[model samples]
Target: MSEQAPAGWYPDGSGSERYWDGAAWTAHVRAPQPAPPAPPTDEAANVFSKLGTAVKKAASDKKASKDEALRLHEERAVAAGRLVTSGIFGTSTIEIYEHGFVRVAPGGERYAEAEKITKKTPYERLRSIAFGVPEAERAHDTEGPGSPIEGAVMQAMSGIVRGGKLLTKGTAVGIAATGVAHLASNSARKSNLVIATDKTIHTLTNQKHNGFIQVSQKEHNAVAVALVEAGNAVLGIEPVAVAQPSISAPPDAAPPAQISVAAVAVTPSLSDRIRELSELHREGILSDDEFSAAKGKLLAGL
Candidate 1:
C-alpha cells in the first residue's frame, strides 16, 4: 500500500506472521512462540512420561475401535439374518446361518476357492448342511522309504509298473490324484462343511497354509441348537400344552337301589341285542374277546 513498510514482523494476510525487509519478503519467517522449556532432567522425564501415556491411550483407543467394529458387524449380521452361530477356528472363521453359511479362509489358494464358492451360493437355496473329515485322507501318506538305494529300486519298479495295463485305467489314477489334491488343499481344516440343497451338496474347507479352524464342543452344540430351531420353524411345528380331563364324583350322594321284581321271561329283539352288545363294548363292560364271542352267539341265534 505504501512505498515502504517498516522491516519487521507483519501479518502476511494468510494469518502467518512474516518478516518484510526493505523492498520484498525476506527468507526469514516469524513462527508462533513455543512453550517454555522445563528443567533439563525434568523435561526428559516428562517427555518419556508423555510418550508412554500417548502409547497407552493409543492402545486403548485401538482396542475400543476393534470392539466397536465387532459389535457393529454382529448387529448387521443379525439384521440380515445371516448369523445363526459363529466361531473362530484358528485363523479362519466359520458362520452357520438359517439359510446358508460363509467360511472365511485365512490364506493360500483355498481362500480364493472359498471366496468363489461364497459368490456362487445364494442363501435361499440352502436346505441342509453336514460336516466331517473325508475318508480319503488316508491316501496322503506315502509308504516308501527315503533312502537312496530304496529310492532307486522304487524308481525302477515304478518305471516297470508304468508300462503295465494298470496305467491305462484312469479310475485309480483319478482317485489317487483327487485324494492328493484334497489332502493338500484341506490339510488345514479340522473338518469340512458340507452344504446341501435339494439337488446337490457343496464341500467347504476352512484352511490357510498351515492353519485350520478347530471348532470347540460348545460351538458345535450351539450350531446343533440353531439348526434344530431353524428346522422346527421351517417345518411349522409349534409347541402346545395338552389339557387333562377332569372327573368329579357324582355330588357325593348314593342312589336308592331298585327291588328285584318277579321273573317275567322277556327276550330282547335281534337289533336290540346287537345294540346292547355294542354299547357294553363301548362302555368297556365287555372285553374284546367276550364281545366277539357274545356277538357271534347272538348272530348265530338270529
Candidate 2:
C-alpha cells in the first residue's frame, strides 16, 4: 500500500514468483521454487488432549486394542510444525503426521495436557488443499469447512455447553456457532497453508515463537508438501517425480552402458590449459581465434 515496499520477489497471486521493484510488479517472473528439504522433528503424540471425541475417534478408534491405537497415533516425521506467539496466550503449534494433522491452541506450544485444546483431522477427511492466497480463497468460498482457528474456539465452547446442558439441541447450537466462526475466522489472512477437509477448512501460518507476524517459509513449505503428500496418499495418488530430488538413475534405467552417470569428475579451473593456448597464440603457431575457442573445449572433457 506504500511506495516504500521493499524491492523483492513476492507471490504474484499465482503459484509463480514476481519481482516487486518497491513500487509495482515487474516483468521479471520465474517458476515456483520448490520447497527446500528440511529434516522434520520426530514428534509423536502419546495421548489425545482436550480434543473433541469426534476428532479423537477419527484419528484412532477407541474400541481398538491399545497397541493398535498407539500405532495409529504415532506421528510421522513427514512435516514438522513451527511455534507461533499469541499475545498473553503463550505459543501455539501444529503437528503433521502420516495419517493426519493436529491443531494446538494458543495456550502453549505443547499438547496432550488436560488444559490444552487440540483438533485432529485425518487425511481421509481432507477433500482438497490449495497453497496460494487466491486459490485458497476460492476453495474457502466453495468448500464446507470452518476456519481451523474457529474450530478450536468452537471445540472449547463445546465443553462449556456440554456441562451446562442449557440447550436441548446441541448439534444445532454447534452449527450456529460454526457459522459465526466462519465469518470471524481470519487467521488464514496471515497463513501460508490452506486445507479443506470434510469437516472444516484450515488456514494457518508457520511462524516462529517470538515473531507473531513473520512466517517461517522453510517450515511452511515443508508442512505444505507434507500435507499434500498425505492428502494424495489418502486419494491413492503419489507425489510428482520432481517432489524429491535424487541423483540416482530411474527405476527403468538399464545397467548396460549407462551414460547418465550420477557424478562426473570436472576440473575446477583450466588455468594451465589456458596458459598453453595463450603461449601458442603469442608464438603465432595458432591463430588467436582458434586458440580462444579450443581452450574452453579442453575442460568439456576433463
**Distance from true position, residue 13, model 1, in Å?**
72
Predicted candidate 1 versus true structure: per-residue lDDT over 53-143, tens digit per residue: 9999999999999898777666545543655555533233345554343333322332422233243233333465444432223233221
**lDDT (tens digit, per residue) of candidate 2 on 156-219:** 3464466632222533343354453442232232234555665576654443332221212233
Q: Record all residue pairs in model 1 with backbone atoms less than 3 Å apart, i.e. clashing.
A: 89-213
By lDDT, who's the top model here? 1
Q: What is the C-alpha RMSD of each candidate to the true structure, in Å?
A: 29.8, 39.9
Question: In candidate 1, what residue range of length 10 has the lowest lDDT sum?
Answer: 209-218
Per-prediction tally of clashes:
1, 2
TM-score of 2: 0.24
